[model samples]
Target: MPKNKMKSGTFIAMCVVTVLFIVMPLFLQVSVIRNAIAWILSGLRYQEYKSAYLGLVGGLLGSWLAITGAIYTQRKFDREKEEKRAIEEKRAKEIDKENIKEICREMLWSEIRQNDNSLSCDNGNFIKAIMEKNDCYFYNRDSHRITTDNWNFIIDKVISMDLELAIKLMHLYKYYEFMTDFDGSADSAFTKSQLDFSKYKECYQDVVEYLEFPWAND
Candidate 1:
């Protein structure tokens, strides 16, 4: 039999036995019981009365033991059931957390690749044209600040797990923001910002390489 069914069966049987021995006799008027009560009431010998009283005590004791055992079994079953349910709930939560992490990883990876491609092509052209002291208007017009939306979505998780990566991404994205907001018409500001672009590009490269070999960070 299953453990639950067996536990229930044993508990029920114990309850029935306890009721029959302890509760039923109080109301039951069988001839044997009636005669016993009469014998006691008639002032039977002290020795005989003492033996009968001892028997009653033994019967009550047995019933009490049966009740105690039944209660213990039921409690044990309940405790085990609660523990099993808790274990299952914890496992389910772990699975859900892992699923969220997986989704975040895929999304982050896509954003990284997209930004890396932009930096290598359009952004690279703009930086090169500026450094060469050539007309950079067309190159600058074709390039824009990189998107940081995807990184923002999972920034908290990334920072919690990898502080170094988080810092690198922050520096790179901040530089992109500066680039977008920089006054390109001011010669002095444009020269300073263009010079800093190399540093931002280095930070971006660091993040990409770190992500590529994530185990090294660990």
Candidate 2:
């Protein structure tokens, strides 16, 4: 059991014992028990009995003080240790973010964004044409395009820094995955076109804004 629990149990037991010591006589009709209790109480009048009583009281007080001090010391140590652990964890996360930021900086965002913009614009135009019910055959022009590879490394860490960015990033990449999937399991382009591409555009813009801060500058 924990030290605090043990101490609390001990204290409760002591209180119960003390209460019984005082109250038991009132309930019990035994004359011998009452006489014994009376004799011990009357003995307080003698110097030897008083000294022994004082010694017992002094011993209990000393033990209580010692136990209380030890508990306080242990609690203080535990609190300090917890605080230190939290500080270290915070520091580690900050360091991890910085490292991730460095990785992002190494990536050529300008070039990647340019490619993404061109591809998304073309796809949007195609979707618009198809939505118009144009009889032309749909061609997947951006099928070969891949934009999420560089981001896979730090994508998980980005959530801690900017959850919205992480969510948008995942949303856009999921669309990309859907577009690239040529298997029969994938949905038709017309079905995929009905999605809100504006969100993906917003995601791109957010990524640009997030990475263009002074700390992430080229």
lDDT of 1 by residue, 83-167 (tens): 9999998897666555545655577666555655654555466555555554433433246335567767566666655556567
Candidate 1, residue 94: Cα displacement in angstroms equals 2.4
Off by over 4 Å in 1: 1-45, 112-146, 150-218
Q: Which ten residues in a row have the lowest lDDT in candidate 1?
A: 136-145
Which candidate leads in lDDT?
1
Off by over 4 Å in 2: 1-45, 108-112, 122-146, 153-166, 181-190, 213-218
Q: How many backbone clashes can be found in candidate 1?
A: 0
Could you tell me every candidate's TM-score relative to the true structure? 0.39, 0.59
User: Candidate 2, which ten residues in sequence have the lowest lDDT sum?
Assistant: 179-188
Write candidate 2's Cα lDDT for 11-105 as tens digits.
55655555565567585578888777567768578778866885686577556656665766677688789999999998997776666655565
Give the candidate number with the greatest TM-score: 2
